[model samples]
Target: MTRITAVWTARDDLAAMLAALNVDGDQCRYVGGAVRDALLGIEAADIDIATRLHPEEVMARLETAGLRTVPTGLAHGTVTAVLPNGPVEITTLRRDVATDGRHAEVAFTDDWREDAARRDFTINALFADPATLEVTDYFGGLADLDARLVRFIGDAGARILEDHLRILRYFRFHARFGGAADADALAACTTHADRLKALSRERIARELLLLLGSADPLAAAQLMADCGIWRVILPETAPDGLAQLEILLAREGQTGALPEALLRLAALLPTDPLLADTVAARLRLSKTQRLALGRYATPWPTSGTARQIAAEVQPADSVAPWLLLRAPDAMVSEGLKSLEGWQAPQFPLGGRDILALGVHAGPAVAKVLGEIRQRWIAEDFPEADRVRQIASEVAQSAG
Candidate 1:
């Protein structure tokens, strides 16, 4: 008899919604991720409800109780009851009638076991009574959860065949929850890796990014590559840079900064600007993300002094990728720390300043300004007076 008592379950809004739906002893319970996360002592991000009542009845009861209801997924027997805390998706128990690997045709059911059997994994199929904190495990989800194993509810291949996206979801879940891949599950994922092409690029990108964003995605990423799953989705990339990722994660932890998903993704890529362009196009990353990745992929100078290169690269975003690529290098680490308060020195001479120096307003003035700026940067940006004197000399020579 496993029980979960968590803030999500004890919320008054949730209790009220459950009470409204459970009028006359109608069964409704918290299901899926909420139950699993609560039992694991992680704060549940969303609360989903499975009910014996049909979708219409669930909607009618909630509406009559003065709670807002949205027919968010009515065709799939789901309705959302919006509460102050967050939206609670109330869905009638369902069994799959047909599945074409991408979409499913489901039939509503009253039997909880039927619904549990159709779920992707055993650990995600557990249900908990909102009122009594009692959990119903038709399958051995509790045992699997205790062992930190993510196994399919029944046949691994059959479950994956129902929705190929579950293949990535399998790895994503393992990354967050800390589990080794079930043998059968890994085999099924590898066999059906090609089916991932049928999924929309947006869908594939979303799942892959989520996997990459997990607490420790390196192991799952390596497994995906070894099994050809990585090739199916992102053949141009490799997991060879995972060691750099570990270092970047450690640095982020030390600084108390939120982990940047794009940075982690960049760590997995080769330092080739062309590959970054291809990946950005393939993943349809946002404009900002693409720019960051493009800068990250730019090759750092291997020959220059650290300070010289650091002065050349001013934007923190530009320097961050190089530092991450060369993480734990004492020189690179020191350069990164030095950049904390450093601002790029402004060029002392502009086109107007050149003009004031008797240099005619033309390409020669621009050329002389450029040369003086180069000297300034090379000299590590000397005092403004010295730079101005140097600029004046260059401008006079050009004139």
Candidate 2:
């Protein structure tokens, strides 16, 4: 038997936990993304541990060892062990008892093979015992990770039926892995496309956004569309719209991608309030994001020289120029133009100023005050003399 060793040299934390687990001299390793990413030479963010000990046993031993334990997902046989290094998520090996394409009923067992079978993909199913730093590969996860391929543990269609979200996950993992999607898996995803509608809008929106914000979003999106998953996920999008989206994606291809959901939506659907409102409501976007989407659907001055536009229209000085440029309407810029550095000159020309200028304080004062403010924005607030000149013209017109 070939022994598998973890690529990372440092993991005293894993050793401590293994001792606490009563594994004594037995193997416990850091598994999943950390091990896979280490092998791939990418930075791993979180460390996950899969132990041969059952959930209840692991919890008892950790608590006995004086470690704070949180049953983050006890139903699924997972516990969070907060240690000095970091919070390590330790889950008992389990197999799915039942799945409704949305949620699952799991049964915990001591068999690592059963646990590996429950994972979404082969690359993710790998585990390492952190203490001795030995990797346990039950499904050839190490080889798949080396090939940069994402394959289901057993059958693709079966996996999709078990969790509809996996459809989106497939695309997201493919984009992140920077690898071509498997042809058979892609076909299975297409066959089960309608199951995606069973997923919540929030889940679909989140996964789709994550996929879009990836390095090769266009490729992932194109794959989704070709596989028939895009139609099920975003029923409103049309082929012509996707073409336009491809152009936008290419424009944003270099780096620092912003997942402007509204801008992306606009490329497919017309600037219609119904479309924008429906998407915002379904996706439950933040107030700021919703407002940005609404602005995109409305009419705005998108064409013309930058100088003709108001300087305030650019952004709040704190906002990105790309965001302002992507806004549906140029109202942001228009608002800036109106509010620029000019703000009615403190109304040194107010109702009081107007009455002192021999103007009555009735509706006439209001009219004169309004006129002065407009003049300020139009003439760039020349001075109080210019304000008074405009005020008098308004009082004369009213007379």
Best by TM-score: 1
Model 1 local distance difference test score: 0.82
Poorest stretch of ten by lDDT in candidate 2: 314-323
RMSD of each: 3.1, 5.4
lDDT of candidates 1 onward, in order: 0.82, 0.69
Q: For model 2, which pairs clash?
A: 28-129, 28-130, 29-128, 29-129, 29-130, 30-130, 296-328, 312-336, 313-333
1-399 in candidate 1: lDDT tens per residue? 779978777679888888898888848988999999999999988889999999999988999999999999989998999999899898999999999889999999999999999999989999988767889998899989988898888898899889989989999998887576788888888888999888877788789888878877878877787678877887767556766677767776765545667777777778787898889888888777777787777776665545556666645456655665544465555666666666676666678888888887778887988888778877777999989889878877775
Worst 10 residues of 1 by lDDT: 324-333
Full-model lDDT, candidate 2? 0.69
Identify the runs in model 2 with alpha carbons over 4 angstroms from their true place.
1-15, 25-27, 253-269, 296-300, 303-399
TM-score versus the correct structure, for each prediction: 0.87, 0.76
Q: Model 1, stretches more than 4 Å misplaced?
A: 239-258, 303-318, 326-328, 340-351, 364-387
Q: Write the per-residue lDDT of candidate 2 for residues 216-310, one digit (tens) a residue.
A: 56677778888988678777775576776775565455333455645666555555656777777778877766665555554444553222233
